[model samples]
Target: MLETIYTENAPKPIGPYAQAIKVGEFVYPAGQIGADPATGQLVEGSIKEQAKQALLNLSAVLEEAGSSLDQVVKTTCYLSTMENFQEFNEAFGEQFAGHEPARTCFAVQELPLKALCEIEVVAVVKK
Candidate 1:
């Protein structure tokens, strides 16, 4: 069976999708943007700032699913442009820190709410 994850600390889904879903031993969080959960509006700032907020949002969803950054086994990141790659990487690195998870990043044409970046992760739920 699968369990849907939700948390007020993260932005509500802008579409018909759950924040994350848990199955068996893992949780898969949907891609997160820089939108503030309280306002449902994209945070105003540079890619670094936006990326940080995205990670923070991802964290909230993961925590709600009984997982965390430390337990993250893999990640997929999307950026609107490659121009901000360096700053985005720095922000992502800051969050992952010593426990870096396998990641795949790509530059996309556009994003929801005009967000500069979006992040998602797969993590092992705590037993």
Candidate 2:
């Protein structure tokens, strides 16, 4: 069976999709931007700050799905500019330290809300 996941701590989905979906032991989160849930505003700052917020958003969705960042098995990162890759990695790496999940990072022409970075995660939820 599949279950939809949501949480007020994470920004509400802007389109027709749930924050995450759990099937069996795996939880897959949608790509998250740097939008602040309470303020409903994109986080403003350097790429590192934006990346941190995006990871935080992904973390909230994982928690809602009965998972945690430590359980994340894979991640896909999108960046608005390749030049910001180093700054983004500094923030993203700190979040997943010691838990090194498989990942792919790429530069994109744009992102929703004009976010500097976005991240999606796949994690395992204990059954």
| TM-score per candidate, chains pooled | 0.97, 0.96
Model 1 sits at a Cα RMSD from the real structure of 0.8
lDDT of 1 at 82: 92
Off by over 4 Å in 1: none
Residues forming the 10-long window of minimal summed lDDT in candidate 2? 89-98
lDDT tens digits, residue span 25-115, model 1: 9998999999999999999999988999998999998888888889999999999999999999999999888888999999999999999
The lDDT leader among the candidates is 1
Give the local distance difference test score of model 2.
0.90
- lDDT of candidate 2 over 53-79, digit per residue (tens): 888998988988889999999999999
lDDT for each candidate structure: 0.92, 0.90
For model 2, name the residue pairs that clash.
none
| Most TM-score-accurate candidate | 1
> Candidate 1 at residue 125, lDDT?
90
